[model samples]
Target: MWIESTLIAVFVMVLLLDWITLIVHCIVGVGLAWLAYSLTTEAPRLEHVTLIHLPIIFFAVVLGTLANYVTEVVRLEQERAMLATAGSIAHELRTPLLGIRSGAAGLRNFLPALLSAYQLARENSLPVVAIRRSHLATIEGVLERIETEANYSNAIIDILITNTRLPKLGHEDLSPCSMMRCIRIALERYPFSVDEISQIAPVTGNDFIFEGVELLMVHVIFNLLKNSLRHIAMTGKGEICIRAVSSSQCNQLVFRDTAAGIPSEVLPHIFKRFYSLPATGDNILGSGIGLAFCSEVVQAFGGTIECSSILGEFCEFSLKFPRIQS
Candidate 1:
């Protein structure tokens, strides 16, 4: 079926492209045939040009169509090859990334105790451990940065995997998830710089729980946070707020950021699949799948996601989920 549809599409495109020539050929062929019949026939003689124009029209239509079809076929084949290569590369990179993430987790857990022991030894005046407290503090800071970057890398990998897998959101195990807990975990996992950390919103109500695919909820929140941070980094200062509330029929989570808000013209298309915003000096081009993916996942979980923004002021994303009764 796909092959048949593709062939038909290729034919239609080729015909559209060569329609003018085809029309001219038909007119010429018919006119010459009429002239030839007028000249040669007893009733009306016909000219030899009829023979020339008829074959020309036939050959032009057939050969021109074939050329267009082959060109399209080759272009599609090249695109297919490129996509396959990209998929292969992504697959190869995931293994090493998983190992690095695990190692980083171990180091993050071990480094604190090691630092504390060094501090204790220094306080007791042990000669070998008498390093400056400032030096120890610096090492601790570096370790923290390492852990943060590692988490950031892993989150990026998760996004890539999600994009590649295009995970269908339904039929997963649904579990009761606390909005407040998910927000805290996403913040901890997100790679916020030292100064940016000060701007994070405090967790709100603890009772706002709902049934969801917990891992997916985390990724959705992380994507929102990551986008906000990227925009905020342009101005060197901004705030992100996550507020949760319950209404009569739904539980609402509003994620607002005082970053470079989306332009009015661009705002309407933000959730469109593969539609990226134009890149400016401060922002990198996006794959444009993040928000679309979020929308799909939300819908699959029987929820709705919406966004509102005012350029240069703020952007807000609101997610509403149907509350499940215990």
Candidate 2:
């Protein structure tokens, strides 16, 4: 009987040891998994084997997700702070820029008058004949060009300010305008001209009258179109296609371009403020506010903007909006 009791005691001790080892293993696994997630760019995908660690793995995943969320929140806060600071500095600088531009324009306008007076004097007086009228004309032309450039700079600064200020949407009913029609209208208003409008199709959604800001939405579409055009123009032989389709629950508008596409490495940051891809060329103008504004507008309207591209083939952007229920 004593031997029997002794055997049972030994078995109980062994069972206790096994449970303790399992717990220790789980704690170790969770720590390692979390470390991996923290160090990598890729998201964590927990597997069935990971569940063998149970509560420990679950806590680790939760902690990892929380960590990621905190990181993003912090990043966004930093960006917001930077944007505010830059906007303030730009506002202060704009006053002087505007003054300079205005003075330059006034001087340019009076330059032609001054040249004409000089010519008249030269023609009227024998001693002044040595001053050639051509030299005076050249000086006037240079001043005019400088004034034109100053005006352009002021316009660019105005656009930057407009983009920095997040304007609220106007609650106006938008008619169910054809996606093609909207594209055509936006294109007409755009600064550049297109030889042809290719492969654009109709889309059904809330009429342009839906509750949103019409001008801002138009600006978003126009910006996307301009971006596509800029890329296609670079290729010298490319086209842009606009298409829209309505699924049961959502409506999608797609803009596809046949130009050399965006590189995969830069695709993710395309919508980020001031984040322009090097492959897009240094000469690409604008403050890199276009796509970022589009993203803001889409999100405001409860939609999403997504891009897909192949390095040498094509780039496509999809805008998805939830169908408005009557």
Candidate 3:
């Protein structure tokens, strides 16, 4: 009956939980069974058998309980990690929301005044002063501001979904997406602060197409751009040069930033899930999931992404895809 029960337990537990977890439960279960057998079994040499089994049972129970305790501890730690990740993600979301609100506020103030001035001129047949380029820029900037913020928000949301869902790629959809188009779209969408856009130089006429989703590639590039931009801001040095070039074997997109680069030790771990650098000096929000998310997406698309950096010099990420036979 005990053996049958163990078999039944193993079968059901395997169906419900992972193998490692099931093994842990089995250890504890087996230990408890030994204890019960020693205490309640009707053996012929009752006292002698019980005496021998007592210490063994005790040791088994202790070992099993310790294993169970460790498992629970690991689970609690994971829960705490998830909480921290949620907090960081929430903080990131706020930046874009603030930008959207600020842009809307700018439009709110600028539009009414301009319309009123136009109405005044019509009513009194008075000449209106020439609008300054700065004034016109304000309106366009506000629109760009809103767009950039919205795009930033969407990128983060996609990262969050990818992290949470852990979805596997199956037969879904694929398309031929141009590399140059992706780079331009990410540049247009990223919420760059004043004067930050000037630092980016994207070389043109080096276009190639890959079989993948455009939005996914855009977000991946967004992650790279965001990291590069942040490092540039932090170190106050370097410019970002983006270009796409194809080789005989493969076509690749190069995102090279001449900024304070990643440390040699940190490079290997950058793409790990929930791995992030500590916040420092006004750069309050950071995420560990972005690069990991990019890796996951690119791998799912049947491609590769790699990063190399030299501290104080530059960091470059190359995303390569299978070359199409022309």
Candidate 4:
């Protein structure tokens, strides 16, 4: 009887010990899970924990994902804010720069005549030989250079303004406007030749009244035309085609150029601000803001812009705007 009782007591002790170990393990697991959850969640409530009761590993993963998502969202918002501030400052600078360029050009154009008048007055006073015509000619030449520089400055200012302006939505007046006529008007403002523009496809639209600023639209088209001309001028033989047609859902304008197209790697970032392809040499006069402006304008008009290119074949830009209601 004594041996049997001792054996039973030993068995019970072993069972109790096993139970204690399991409880300890459970506590440790719960503590670890809570720690992980606290670290992951921004502000985890006790009620929330009870409701979900997620596994330790799963909870950690969920918290990690949420943290990453929040971080990314914050980062994106900051970047957008910075872009907007930069754009605003750029817009304000353009008008003043344009005025300065105009003023300088005017001065350059009139300075020679003013100098001539001054020389004439001096000649009438004392000695006929005191004022040299060669001196006046030299002055005129300098003025001409100044005028050239002023004109160049104006061009730069225009490009800067074109790139930075916030896309403004215009009132919709859906009507059939001649796409060809608009193209012609825009081309007349530039130095492109008739032969160059003749290559574009004829386009017409019924719900043509797009809901966007006319000036911004012009800038978009002008940039494409300018880009084409630049390529043609550089390579000596290139063609550009622009076509417009109405789709069931939108109005599409397509621009294609025969020059060496943008590389595949750089194609995605072409619309990004200040992102320019390295192949566009130093001689290229643009400020790299043209396409950025085009993107902004397109988005403002509730439209989409996309590009496709084969390295040696061609580059194409497709602009789609919402169709105006009749």
Candidate 5:
């Protein structure tokens, strides 16, 4: 009886999907029932009602009703499993990544000295041609890029952890912090080739301070750098110039890159969430939320970010934040 009651309830609930339709169905059913009662002197027989047809209708509706509930239950379970797995994976990854970063940092610190010693020994004991100048330069450049990419990868891992664990950005996270410090960290941690690194300019002022979450802003800057570097890499040569200066009421940071710039038609929609360029033959991949994320983060800090570009020439992003005096 309980099972039968549940089935009947499911049937009714399925039929009454919306208020307007439910009302119409209810009025129609009641009118038909009243007419049937008025016409029947004796109680209607099951034989005349056609039992086979009734069972088939009930069977189909009940099947769909239970299937809907089952699908919802499965979907919720899958979401819970995914969240748990993500947390576990982040924890597991952070440990090994920290070790790799430490090792790379150590190599970065001692690499120049090691290279110098090797050069001195080579000159003293062997012919200069034994170790070519171009080979040494290539090795140094490769090592530098490795170190830079290691730092960048660490920052990315940290961001992943933060995204998984941290709550939405709150007012407390927007306390006055050193903008110069964040910018410097972003530059150091951004993945750039040795050549691109050489072209970077210094911050214009010594007094750039702002109010925002340091970590999130770093990600914003990192995102911009990542996008620039990605397009630049496709061409195998590019230059990036970054400058930060204090204005009357705000501090402005300009990042300009001599890379394949965005198209005029595509530029307008670049900041839209999850809107990515179609994969052309070059295979420029993007999550599409990077620029959108940067825009949102800057807005959260009471700032503005704008981009200007000329295709095949350059792309420039200008960010302005209300200057907070120390």
Candidate 6:
């Protein structure tokens, strides 16, 4: 009985809730189930097992029927915690990542000169750790990659945390920001593996200012970059293009990726919150919040965002903002 209940809970949690609630439930449920099992051993086994079965089935039914309510409870807890932090969690993590990034960069810069000194000392026949030819060859790449990974990690952490708090109600936070500059910052800070950035074309010319938060705008760009990359990775053969066009009437940021595009059935619902499709080898079911968050932030900032795609060809997101007079 206990085993059956546990399996049902695990299935519901993974399929519907993504395993977080499983932590609390598994620990508490296992303890309670064990107690029930012990009590069952003392009584008539069949009746006790049947009695235990009722609650578990009820819970499973609730999981199937009230999945959204369960999701709400979890999300409500996250929101409360976020309220307490004011999203400083991202800022808190940044300092340590910055320290690691700085350390890695310093090592990269000074290692070559240190290597030369080590060579001189070896020639002088001083006792030193013998650096192998192979070690020396790979060391520089390692240090550079460390710095890159640190930077990329920091960027991703910021994006993920910030995405949860979209359309931030702080109207006073908006300011005039250059669309081109924001896109550049996002591209520069985004963690792209070797040759990944090469897949992206340069941002189109024509800078325009909009009333927006720079960080929010950068995050919006990051969200787009993430989705595009995920789709391209799924197909394993595609390229990305970002363009910014400005005029008196409208300011537009266009991001296009030649990923084997969204299926017709899934196209209409891409921006729906918490609605992630299942990932099949070459398709677009990501973490589920990215594009939705982008929509929220853009619409919140007095802009509009839209997508157009063709299956097995390409996907493009066009974000339009009111052109602000400089």
Summarize candidate 4's per-residue lDDT along 57-122 as a digit string, tens digits: 344434444555666689768756755665566557667666766776787778878787787778
Model 3 worst lDDT run, 10 consecutive residues = 279-288
User: For this target, which candidate reaches the highest lDDT against the unseen true structure?
Assistant: 6
Cα lDDT listed for each candidate: 0.71, 0.64, 0.72, 0.65, 0.70, 0.77
Candidate 6 versus truth, CA RMSD in Å, comes to: 14.1
Give the Cα error of residue 121 in candidate 4, in Å: 9.5
Cα-based TM-score, every candidate: 0.59, 0.57, 0.59, 0.56, 0.54, 0.64
lDDT of 2 by residue, 1-326 (tens): 43345335434433443434434554675588579777894766766754554565345444544555666689779877766775676678777777877787788778778777877777788455465657766786776566555654554454445556666654353334345456666665554432535422333344322234555666677667667767767776566777677677777778887787888988898887878766557332333667888888778777799999997788999988777677
Provide the global lDDT of candidate 2 against the true structure: 0.64
Clashes of each: 12, 9, 0, 0, 0, 0
Native-to-model Cα distance after best TM-score fit, residue 1 in candidate 1, in Å: 37
Model 2 spans with C-alpha error above 4 angstroms: 1-70, 126-137, 167-209, 225-258, 264-269, 272-275, 279-289, 308-314, 320-326
| Per-residue lDDT over 173-251 for candidate 3, one digit per residue giving the tens place of the 0 to 100 score | 7677888888888777766766788888857557998888887788788778777888888888889988788878888
Candidate 6 has its poorest 10 consecutive residues by lDDT at: 279-288
Question: Which one wins by TM-score: 2 or 6?
Answer: 6
The positional error of residue 131 in candidate 4, measured at the CA in angstroms, is 11
| Model 4 accuracy (lDDT, Cα) | 0.65
lDDT of 5 at 217: 79
Residue lDDT tens for model 1, 139-238: 7777556666766665676665564454555545567788778777877777667877887877564357777777778878877877887788876667
Deviation of model 4 at 278, angstroms: 4.8
Candidate 4, which segments miss by more than 4 Å at Cα?
1-53, 57-62, 70-74, 81-109, 114-185, 188-207, 229-239, 246-250, 272-293, 299-302
